[model samples]
Target: MAAIKPKHQRLVLALIALAAILAAGALATWALRNQASYFYVPSEIVANPPDLDRAVRLGGMVEMGSIEMEADGVTIRFVVGDGTARVPVRFKGLAPSLFVEGSGVVAEGKLAKDGTFIADNLLARHDENYVPRELQDMTEHQKDAVISETVGAK
Candidate 1:
């Protein structure tokens, strides 16, 4: 084989480098395909349900009077609802501290064959101005005691 010219050698090297980068990107995307979580609301879930086997994120308000705890204590069932639709969800784990009825939540899990969302994780959504009930309902003397306990009496 004849020797490659300097100009052609640079072009070949550049092409190989470009090909390597493209291959790396494709490989990364393929590897992360299962890790990518798609978010959907209750209305969308009702309109077009996701595959039962794939992981997904369902976000909406926790329907009031729908939360129920099973005998196992950890398994809880609740309905997530947008204004128009609702999806029943079952989760077997500890819920977030702020998770409560009529509050916004995002559950990450798979859709079960029985049309229930089986959540592996739950995230509660709180407003920016949220305050704990203890703090919000505190009397003046209780607030002063807490402040003094926290900052050692200004």
Candidate 2:
């Protein structure tokens, strides 16, 4: 048997390395196939809902007059809406402090057969101009004093 020349040996090694990398990428993708979550808006969800078993994220503004608490108090129901459509979401947990009507929200979970989104997690979004309720009414000077106090204490 003739030994491969250096040039040929290097080429073979490079091809093997590339194959190994591709195999690693394929394995990673396969392993995380179910872990990936797709994002959809209310309009898209209403047009073509996702599979009931597939986890997905639904993002939209929380519609006014649509939030209600269940008898258990922990389960909250709300409607998320885009300008074109709306999706009802049911979440059985403590929502984030910023979660409220008219705010942006991303609910992560699966869609139900009944068309309601069964959320396992809720993420609330606030605008850049957001101010805490306590600070909203404070004057600029008062706000500065409070800020300095908190900073000094920290």
Candidate 3:
């Protein structure tokens, strides 16, 4: 049998290499398909909810007067709204220090069959003007002094 010419051999090897790379990418995608966490606002979740078991992120402002702590002291429920719709969320464990009524929050978890979001984790969103607790009550002059001192300004 005649051996393959150098040109044909290179082409065959290149095709094989391309096929292998594609297969690896396809496998990676398949393995991580269910690991993706989709983000949704309250209105989006209310309009087209995700599957009960699928992990997702819900982001919105915590509705005023919607927070309820369970008797267990560990479970807290709150409503998140985007002005158009609201989603009830149930979270077990201490919430982030910044989480509060009327504050922006992003909850990561799955939806329950009863239409509640079971949050495994919560992230509190702060505004760009966020100030530390210590500096919150400081006057502008005091804040400037503190900043200058901390920054070693003369």
Candidate 4:
């Protein structure tokens, strides 16, 4: 057999390394496929419902007058809407203080056969310009006074 030149040997080794890295990446993606959750708005979910067994994230505004606590007290049911569509959701556990009617929310869970989303986690969404009630309700002079006080204290 003919001996490979030093340059040729290095080229082969580089190719092998690249092939190994690609294989590892493919394996990792396959293993984590189930862990990767996809996000969808209410309209999208209504148009194309996801597999009942696959985990997904549903994001929309909590419809007003749709929130209801079950008899068990812990289980809550609500309808999430995006103006174009609405999805019924059921969750069990304490919700965040920001989880209120007409507020944006993202619920992570799987869809049930009955078309209800079974949320395992709930995340409240706030606007970029969100401010505390005190700050929002305060006059310009009052806000300046509070800011100065905070700075002086520091």
- C-alpha TM-score for every candidate: 0.61, 0.61, 0.61, 0.62
lDDT tens per residue, model 2, 1-154: 2566877988999999999999999988976764333778887888988889988999877887899999998999999986678899999998999898866788999999999999999999654344576775666666445433432342
Evaluated with TM-score, which candidate comes out highest?
A: 4
Worst 10 residues of 2 by lDDT: 145-154
Candidate 2 regions exceeding 4 Å error are 1-37, 127-154
Residues 73-147, candidate 3: write the lDDT tens digits.
999999987777889999998899989885678899999989999999999975434567676466656744443
Comparing 2 with 4 on TM-score, the higher-scoring candidate is 4
Model 1: runs farther than 4 Å from truth?
1-37, 127-154
Task: Report the Cα lDDT for residue 104, model 1.
Answer: 74
Residue 8 of model 4, lDDT score: 91
| lDDT, candidate 4, 1-154, per-residue tens | 2466877988999999999999999988975774333877777787889999988999877887999999999999999977678899999998999998866788999999988999999999764444477874676576445433432342
lDDT (tens digit, per residue) of candidate 1 on 21-135: 9999998897677444377887788788888887899987788799999999999999987667889999999999979886678999998888899999999975333447787
Compared with the true structure, the alpha-carbon lDDT of candidate 2 equals 0.81
Model 4: colliding residue pairs: none
